[model samples]
Target: MPVSKKLPQLFYGGDYNPEQWPEDVWLEDMRLMKQAGVNIVSVGIFSWAILQPNAENYDFGWLDRLMNLLADNGIMADLATATASPPAWLAQLHPESLPVDENGVRFSHGSRQHYCPNSKAFRHYGQGLVRRLAHRYKDHPALAMWHVNNEYGCHVSRCYCAECTVRFREWLQQRYGTVQELNARWGTNFWSQKYYAWDEIALPAKTPTFANPGQQLDYMRFMSDSLLDAYLGEYRILKQITPDVPVMTNFMGAFKPLDEFEWAKHMDVVTWDSYPEPTAGIPVAAAMQHDLMRSLRGGQPFILMEQVTSQVNWRQRNPLKRPGVMRLWSYQAIARGSDGVMFFQWRQSRAGAEKFHGAMVTHTGDENGRVYREVAQLGNELKRLQALVDTRIEAKVAILFDWHNWWALELDSKPSRDVLFLEQIGHYYKALFDAGIAVDFVQPHADLNKYRLVIAPALYLIGPGVSDNLEAYVQQGGTLLTTFFSGIVDENDRIHLGGYPAPLRKLLGLCVEEFDPMLPDQTNGLRVRGQGDLDGDYKCTLWADIIRLEGAEALASFTADFFAGSPAVTAHTFGQGKAYYVGTHAEDAFVAGMLRRILSDLGVQPPVMTPLGVEVSERRAEGRSYIFLLNHLDQPAEVQLPAAGFTDLISGRKLQGSVRLSANEVLILHKDTEHAV
Candidate 1:
């Protein structure tokens, strides 16, 4: 389900904790919310303690009044299950609910997410509360969407307690079936750690030197699944009681612990929280995260569930968002593929852990504040652009972002500790972003037919059928780009044996004899062979695969070190498609130049040409497209419009030639005459 049927426009507003203040303050909140054009408020997210003050007693009196007040004010409620953090009493009554760290020390109460996901007692009380809340609020007119536990596995992703140990073994048994297969997969024979029985297998905790790599990978999977089970426990109950409400949980963007792709399968709609540091200044990392969340459901529009209006409180030194940064970032979210834009709070707290966190209504209790004004302006813009709701972003290029590969590649025993997964992905993503090209993030197992070009950056782990899928895709005339250290290991973190990049060696027509892992300060030069923009030498760093071309032609060669004049990059024509492999991590300029050449050959072009610091994105709906132009700089920038005259949705002005946008400005252009405008 999408957001509730009643919210036809963009769902706005955010976390509102009325129980944190006096009763009279709620009326003022409603008044200010309407002034700020707030249409929805996520309430009761952290209200478990107040809602059920004791084990046997429950209170719906205040919630009933709050719901009625919200409906009367024409605001919808993204009603939360309030199961994120259990009550202090529950932890006191059942200490087993607490999570124990890898060091085997149990965490105490006071902080949030202290409960162990696999604890039976915790699940019982948590699901019980969810059932009560669901039944009580099922028919409430203000209920819009069901916000499941807030940011699952945020603080405590794993527990080394005995309960988790038992659950982990059961999970392993279910996956591998027998102790013999477990030993084979985990490679237990290496350190004489072979287990004769299922009970002998231990959780991959702090070992003498290092835990088995395969065991560590499996434990990550188990922890993700265990937390997912906890979310599903409440989800099943909520669906059983209020089947109409759409259930969702906020994901921390680019979070590594949980496999969000698997979790997205169970979510009614995808949503995530974004909190980028201001110093980064609109980095490509944040854009990649937005596209990643959009790709979770195959290009479906997701929600901007939680963003700070200004600065975050958790960072060591929280800096305020410069004048228009909040609005710029909010539009960036929508431009990528967000249907709704919401913040982490409606009002700033007077006292709490998040007292300093930015909010729509600050502690000064004035609607005339700069943050409030910017919030109201964006709200009004969203109200005007209601036709853009439910639209989707289309991309001809996709980058594979796999969580399994991320975990395996980051393990302790990798060739180069400097080889970071997301950094590698960011390199490719930034190339495309700077070129004004639209791109989608995809899973390695997702269908490759939709994209003309697929780039897999350091795809270190190739799971079952991925090699075959890529082979088929390449043989059927698709272009693929992958970097060094890819296809080196299987899903079990076991080497593919014959050579590096084992499975893809045949497709790429190359064999890597060995890897040359470079230190941080080391560097090499890559001399381009053919013409075009990549005809010069470029600096290569981090890693270099000693490659020997089989059926592929060398496009570049190492110009330094003992492997000088060796193949550093190669391209092969397989059937009707082409595959290119970069055996070394080259500089950004080389990657961009090579990508531009490849994209040109594949007939892929950006929607519009733009100057640096200006971002362009498009969303399509009802046969019409809306082109978003945003300036991320402190100075004015100009963008040439398409030959066809278009109307600016924000300014309601028709433009034909080049238009200049002021610093931190945004424009939504509708191509020619459009529908539902």
Candidate 2:
């Protein structure tokens, strides 16, 4: 399902909190919103205290007024369950519901997200409020969607309270039938820590030494599912009351604590908040986040749920979104497969933890302000581009990102903590980003037949059926590019015997003899002497693998260390397909050149090749394509058009051969549109 379940038009606007203002200012806020071309606003995201002043009493008068006003003003509300924060009354009443840290200190309620996910008291009160909101707004004209809760597990991803302990025991009992089985699976025999009863089992918490790796892994799985259960508690109620309405919760991009892939399976449409630094200038990080969000739902067009109009107060140094930066980045969101453009707040808070956070209406409250003007400009452009709504970006390439591997690779007892999961994967993704290649961030189990090339980096843990899936994909003529630190362990964090990366040894056609974790400042030389476009000398970092080929032929080899001249990179043919393995991480020149060769071999061309600091992406309709050209440089840049001619949907100007974009400018060229002058 798309985010446009209720409205087919491009959804605009930001998080609206009329309760933050006086009754008199509500009308003025509405006027400002309309002036900004706002159509949709997420209401009541953090209004639990005002909605339900106490556990027993209900107060919908303010919300009722707000909903009515929005409906009257031609605005739709992404109504929240108001369960983001527990009320002060509930916290005061049930202190046990407060989350306890690993050190056994209970967090007191003053700020938001004070309750534990597994807390019975929290769910009881939270679900009760959700049911009432659903039934009340089931028929409201203003309700476009249901926002279940605001960023689940943001603050309290884990709890070490007594309540959690009991739940953990029960959860373990269900996962492993008896204590004997649990001990065997967790390898408790090693430290004379074998359990005799389920009640003896505890969460992987503070200890004199390192905790059991197996216990730590299961706890990670448990917490992710626990948070999911909490979300589904409210999600079920909303679906039961308003089955037609879509439900979503804004995801924190690439959040470490929670597994977003599993959560995405239960969502109606994916929506996430992105707060990229304006000082960074280039939107590389933001693009990866957008691709991950879109990939969560299999390339579905998602809403840009919340972004700051300018600067966010959370960072140590917050800077403004220089002039056209906001509008250019907004189009970047659209280009990467977002159907809607929105921000954290419609109106700036006069006083709160986020008062300094930028908004459409700034602290000065001037509609003519730079932020406000840019937001209105974006909204105005979005209104005319409704056709881009529900449009999808088709990519022939994908990058594998598994939270299981992410959790396992970075565990305390790893080869090198410096070999960060995101860093390794981000390195590969940056190559694709630089080449103007669209990519889907898929899990290993996802279907690979649709992709011409799949890049799997740092696959430290291989779950059941993943190797079989990869083998099948390769046998069916798919191209695979996987890296080192892969296929070493099972899902249980146990090393496979016989050889390093034993599972993938057959498919990858190679066996890793041993791997060296390089120092922070270490670099190994790589020489791809005869690998076509990759025939160059380059440096590798972070990891170096000494490989002995079984059936694979070396394409590139290490030129430094004792492992010099061994297979640093290899190519193996399986059935009708080819699998390329980089035994060690290579430099950007090598990665870019290798990707260029792989993409060129598969005939996957960029939407439009552009110079540095310029990004090109496309969204496809029935037979139409919207090519977005974004200039991220401080000076003007030009891009040669892939098509002969097209109409600039933004300025409605005819463009052909090549187009020039001013510094921090964007142009959405509509391919084969009748408006082509």
Candidate 3:
């Protein structure tokens, strides 16, 4: 977790807002926290209004007493800088700090994240508060970690105000270094959109009809960088004052507005909030989020910063988390490589918008409630499971994920409106997850030589260095699988000249002559022509490419499209390994069968085979493997033991045969072996 020396165990608490309750209830919070085996609590996340009521007035007496009480009770504090929500006084003094929407309407300062990213007034006040907090808490005994500003771009990712427009011009200047280069890259000569001066450039605000795709893509980049500048402002101050205290900000899983890969580089440790909807694909989606967080920093152990104890108050239909579902999800996070299990809040609120939100201490203030009892049980289990901290899930497979590609591919003038980046990512990742194969999410230009199998899905926009990086990986005997619509455009959202997939044509041994984007209600069939392993007749939808083979051989052909006999799937042998291309978005049956066969050819096996609803994952450290078996079904299920004998950490039971698990069950087993780390 890379925290202070005072916190040497697993973290197991949530947001603690002592300012919400009176002094009497504050004392009760300490008692309940101890009773629930809580070791750490996030303090003062949204207390700016009370911390400093006026511009010159500061109140620290209550917070001082709370910190002392927590330290005396043997609890650690994940202290927030209190910069997420601006106080009412700041808003009244300078309303220009308020953010504006895309339609040129400025939002009133009532909700959280109401300030603009480039507002000078907001930065001035935010910096002042951060300096004071860092100086005051540098040597405090309760301080273990520093929480930067809340979610980076929850509501106001893009601001169309005059202030932001001026900054966007400056960003463009720095990015291009000259007006001539901006014109050349943006391809402004296409539709009489060339700019003669820097002042002519403006924010991608509401435009009549369609805006320039190049301009819109650059605006997304500018917005992402502007938010990053806000984080770095507070981070530099915290590090200069308290260099020993680790600093981080909470991330929303798979958030598209801001680039998480870039943000993870500056953080001391990664942390994110997980709020998966109660749906059929909950297990796979939650695991994908965990893997994405863990992969942000090259497989560093992250913390589950915020999750619901039971029912949340925000969703359209908030469903109460069934009994044992909370614990099951927590263990799933740890299984993928999370060091801590935390929640959105410690005690449920009695007022405000989040009063109905579940917490460790319920509104009834009873320690005997169903949700509170489950929280206590899980906290105690975490205390005994501290040995699993810092362990890693070492997967040999890597999934390429790039935010630039995602943003550019989903721009307005694309081939198909139904084609999205995350959907294709989910398709590829689910195939691996359902087979019980752990996977890591990586950027396009990252080092891919360590992985045996690399899967890139819907890589519609390939930059300069990415092609070289991927080509070298395939040349060095690594298996690569990419889908349709890849290698189409460069970083500037300009199509590559000569042919489609131009950069990767030699490596893939095929060319996409044309993209046949199917309408939302259309479908296509996939006829298997590979080895007699998969279903002969499979269907696809959303997209099918007319592929022309250069040196590759067809593995599957489209059945109902104009290019029915053309290659829908092809396999080519590049330098010492193989590269497969799927010219169509086939259904799960075909994708899963092909991926499983490829993994079998590489001799990469799953940890253990289980029933349909059961998930198996393993983490290894110090010559020992910790196996996690979770049942995501509503009914009981059984799994065969993959080893001769092992010790169960949850029940302290030793077994050598099959084990039966009730609904929503979890069994963390330990076995000694030499893992190929």
Candidate 4:
């Protein structure tokens, strides 16, 4: 219920739905929530069916009762428009609202995200329902922020219907302006794809002979825009009624179906669900997502809207999060920049697709379950650590992660098939994360000089303002790094043909003449030049861009290729700063070693207490700073505390200089002295 402009320290509680149960159950739920210190509940997420069963018939009897109960309990309701999925009656009556697939097949009801965003029937009914709900509950005392929709990627690529085609034509016109431009971008001249009029164009269909990647990429962009337009319409309508309430939509982390970065520009707040893969390197993946979400709002903290305390129901092999893993992961999000912590379902469901997903309270309604106990403990600890509210995490490292480049790289049919984008970015990210260096995952347009060291791996597509930003950053004494296939294409996916690397050639001081694409098993030798203590040779593979140094100095050279002895790694001094361009996909060891040396040179040092294999992150507020040290290892590890005396905020133990941490344990140290960057 704390709606202060300065966000409260811990965002307690989670999604609650009293409408799903009986009155007696609702009463008990409230009792348990208060005991657990639950302060907020995201209500009415999927209540569209109950709210509007029929077009002309609306019911708020149950919702009114639910709100009154929350108000009595002093719980803030994160009210939702319930417009993610419309009622079955709407789709049954107006079939056009149901989306058609790329294969020219229209979908049936029964699943969420079934409505076509471009369908007028769907837009009218959806916005009308939202308008009604906003007017009805705008003045409710229990209302917190507005959650516009649930996770937005349940529906795949949509809208090949007639209405969609018309809108798609309009979008294309706005983008390309003329058929000649469209033809050139899509390479229409190669296969007699010359379009005389806008009407002649069609979406990328899943036909046996007509699967064009460029066209499909554009279709993805269009679909994302279409959904964003729908979301914006609902948001504006709600804002018209409740202007002060923040509006957000739950986003699926690392979802490839939609461009969430573009969608984030219009939202009042950025929020996302975190469900990491159970693989060996999930921490890196999770960190990448957390940083990406923060970058969407220009480094502002986002809401960790949903994560399971234990096993989930959807994965084929559901594995429980090991002891202490949940706490560590939650702190990982907070250490990055998360303002709130929540889960999908407060209480486990008895029937539905997510019946088995872990919840705060199980179906048995027991308060002593393992998950419930963990939630209870976290709730208590959050109550004590109230100083972290609205605090910021500072970083000197910047890793440029662009959705446009990701999209473009995947669509590249000519590059080596093994050159996956996320995997490459993740390799660098893991190196930095393991080194305990705070990294900002950014888009091309982010502020450059805020970071001392900038790492841009696989920057395949450069946008309008990126080159200038990098140029400025380098001129202002910032270290810039980029890899192969960079500066090859502009925002429109058109080739920048003044040489291989367009505008960055001057900054990099290298001209790429030819590139060698190799299979996964193929290997190349990278020999270090200009002998030093770290001078040696290494193995590398995948696509290698052969370069000739114009003004830069070569650090490494190819050993056995036709272009042997050519510069594989070059460093160029722009003004007060420098740029390193790695023209090949180098080995992880070499990359880590090179980055370590570069970071050392740039004075990008982690805290003196930073340890290997452990995560060290710091967040600073007005009067104090919290240093989070987490042991992600399976075995116990010892840690060196800050030189100055400090206290463990989580454990209430005072310490002087050093400490030992158990496996998967986390320590939040409160430093008395302030260090502002």
Q: Superpose all Cα atoms of candidate 4 onto the true structure and report the RMSD in Å to 1 decimal.
A: 2.4
> Per-residue lDDT of 591-641 in model 4, one digit per residue for the tens?
888888888887887754556767888877666688888888887788777
The residue-by-residue lDDT of candidate 1 on 535-590, one tens digit each, is 99899999989998999999999998889999999999997899999988899999
Instruction: lDDT for model 2, please.
Output: 0.88
Most lDDT-accurate candidate: 1
Candidate 3 wrongly placed segments (more than 4 Å): 279-281, 672-677
TM-score of 1: 0.99
* Candidate 2 lDDT tens digits, 235-297: 988888888899888898899888999999889988988888888868788999899999998
lDDT of 1 at 585: 89
Per-residue lDDT over 1-677 for candidate 3, one digit per residue giving the tens place of the 0 to 100 score: 43457777778999999898889988888888998899999998899888888999888889999999999999999999898999989989999999999898988877898899899998999889899888987899999999998888987788888889999999999999999999999999988989999999987788887788889999999899999999999999999999988999999999999899999989998999988875544578889999999999999899999999888888888887888999999999998999999998998888998999888888888889898999999999888886787888989999999999999999998888888999999999988988889899999999898889999999999998988998899999999999999999999999997687998899999888888899888999989854778749888999999988999999999998578878889999999889999988898989989999999998888787778778888887877788899999988998898756877877778866798989999998876333322
Off by over 4 Å in 2: 673-677
Candidates 1 and 2: which is better by TM-score? 1
**3 or 4: which has the higher TM-score?**
3
lDDT of 1: 0.90
Q: Give the winner by TM-score.
A: 1
User: Candidate 4 regions off by >4 Å?
Assistant: 1-7, 208-214, 278-282, 529-533, 673-677
Per-model TM-score on C-alpha atoms: 0.99, 0.98, 0.98, 0.95
In model 3, the worst 10-residue window by lDDT is: 668-677
lDDT score, candidate 2, position 261:
92
Q: Rate the local accuracy (lDDT) of all candidates.
A: 0.90, 0.88, 0.89, 0.81
